[model samples]
Target: MMSILGLLELNFSFQLVSFPAVILKRLTFHPDDCFEVRTPNLASLGQEEPWTPNTLSLRLDLSDPSDPNVSISLYFDPGTRPLGLLPGSKILLHNVEHKISKRKNVYCRFINTSVLTVISFPPSLQKRITTDETSFTRLYLRDIRGSVQGMQQAVCSITRISRLTLRWNCIWCGKLFTKGRCAARQEGFCSSDCGRFGASASVVVDDGTAESLALVEAQQVAVMLGLTAAEWKVLKDEVWMRGELEYSYNQQFHDPVADPLWNVVAALCCKASSFRRFNLSFCLKKQLHHQDVSEKTFQLGEMRYATQLLSSPVLFVKNITPSDWKALVSHWQHLHEAEQSTH
Candidate 1:
């Protein structure tokens, strides 16, 4: 099946030329199979100077509901964004270039000959689309650990946070460089030094099922800690000055080790959000309503019910606190204990 996850696994040679217009014009696709827009247009290269030629570069985060674990950043050029494109909107892209960056991030670029169709659903269906896509993409850490393909979302608690390190990558070839030179120069590519500062770190997260290590990039680190890049730099400096930066991170908001039970939605390449609880009692009740079900059958039914609840509109429990997370964890533990006792 054609999916964002599938695209990530496939390798394509780098090409600057666009596909022929004749081929693009004849292509057709179903709206349901098309990738849904997760985030709106983002200026990938920032603002262009007056003297510089107009590039009109922007990116959109798009994912297919069939494979919600993966989302691709699509860059647009040579034209303005399509009208009526918004989050939850579906888009069918044709003749886009797929390239792997220096960070091994897979993304698509819309060239001059690319064709894009913005598919907007009805007002009633928009919420359903968003809920279904979000729920499908969100999985437990255990479930996502073995997946070798695309980015998977999980609501996990920070078990451990590592120290941040400063890194630089070439803008032209997107290659990492430490010495003041582009490695791509040896391969006859651009020798010009176009370095950009980036912060990198890893964090261990647990979602009660399993623990997994997740890498936090520059932008995500700032968002996950509720701080801007500049603020994070200042805090890092302070921590470095204290001579404790090698072992621990400064607790400006909440200590990751002490307050490890956070409700933030974490993914490989995404920002964090405020804590929120999800109600699964209705799902349990619904599953238990079926009488005379075998233990195995009941367990299967419970899983189905949980999935249904996640896809439902009323699943999100907003503005939840750390204490609420503790209570929720205890409640789950009790439920598991009761189930074991019954067995």
Candidate 2:
């Protein structure tokens, strides 16, 4: 297996070789470059037009297994792009072209004759890879407010949901529009006429120690609510009707109307035994570790730890069992109480 570093250092072109790497990110291709040519209406009249095969240009950020720190951008011009290509996917590149661009950036390109293979790791190996890449620790929302960063795991409750906005984006040009025609079509750049609807809502979450606002993206919201975009649109009237009925019930007993339409929806979604506890992973901008602070205590003990407020952090929410939630909560409470006593 060729290493990405060694591949870049090659002075001459080589062939019939393979390199194993993990994908870090998928870059977007230009609308014009990936768009397919539409068959003209005059073709029905027996006017033969030259056929142009649609081609794909995909760019991926890859890291070599030999040296995870070393990463490089690779461009693919394959006849057909592989499906299920995502970040953290392992792949093997065969007979790729190594070239330096005008900006002096070393990158690899996969030509028409090149081959790409998606490889899967064994269950044991996959677990090991995840453990090696991630450092897990239990922390409260208050402790995470400043002292920690990077990927954080926490359990929080939704206190408020607001600013729900729904919109659509052109699949080709990725232009966000409320309604009407896509900008790409107006400019004659795209003819696919494909668009996807997405919705976002601002939510305030509480974990006892502190409350923070998080902007839940379309995917997270959909997963948490167990409702697709289409379902959300279809059930809008029913949801409002249910909300009004609940409000009337609360009024009859003189109870507080704390749960609104979205709030009730969120609460009902979480009522499922599986969704009782959610393991949320948040990617923070700044990176810090407790061991680093301990090691450099004398050098940086007096430094104030500033809270890095989360601004649209990517969240991965997973359901955890009640026993697991209890264990984590107990550990967090003990630590939080100890810290509070000292202060």
The number of the candidate with the highest TM-score is: 2
Q: Residue by residue across 1-343, what tens digits does model 2's lDDT show?
A: 6788876764645543468888776654543565433322211212322111124356778899777899988775533344324555577776566777787677887664454655642121121111222335544554543455456676555544444444566677777432444656767776655566665655555543344555566566665555667866654444323222221112222223753454554454334421233445665434334332321111113433232323322233332212243343234344445556787
Per-residue lDDT tens digits of candidate 1, residues 1-343?
Answer: 1456666764755332222110101111222335332222211112211111112344456666555545677665422233323344455655566678898887777764444544442132221112311333334433331222333344445444544554556767776544555667788786866565565555554443343445555555555455666876665444332222222344343455743222121221223232112211101111112122222111222232111211111111111112233333333344445556787
* lDDT score, candidate 1, position 224: 46
Point out where model 1 deviates above 4 Å. Answer: 1-137, 145-149, 168-194, 229-343
- Compute the lDDT of residue 261 as modeled in candidate 1: 24
* Candidate 1: worst-modelled 10 consecutive residues by lDDT: 19-28
Clashes of 1: 0
Q: How well does candidate 2 score on lDDT at residue 293?
A: 31
- Per-model TM-score, in order, reads 0.27, 0.33
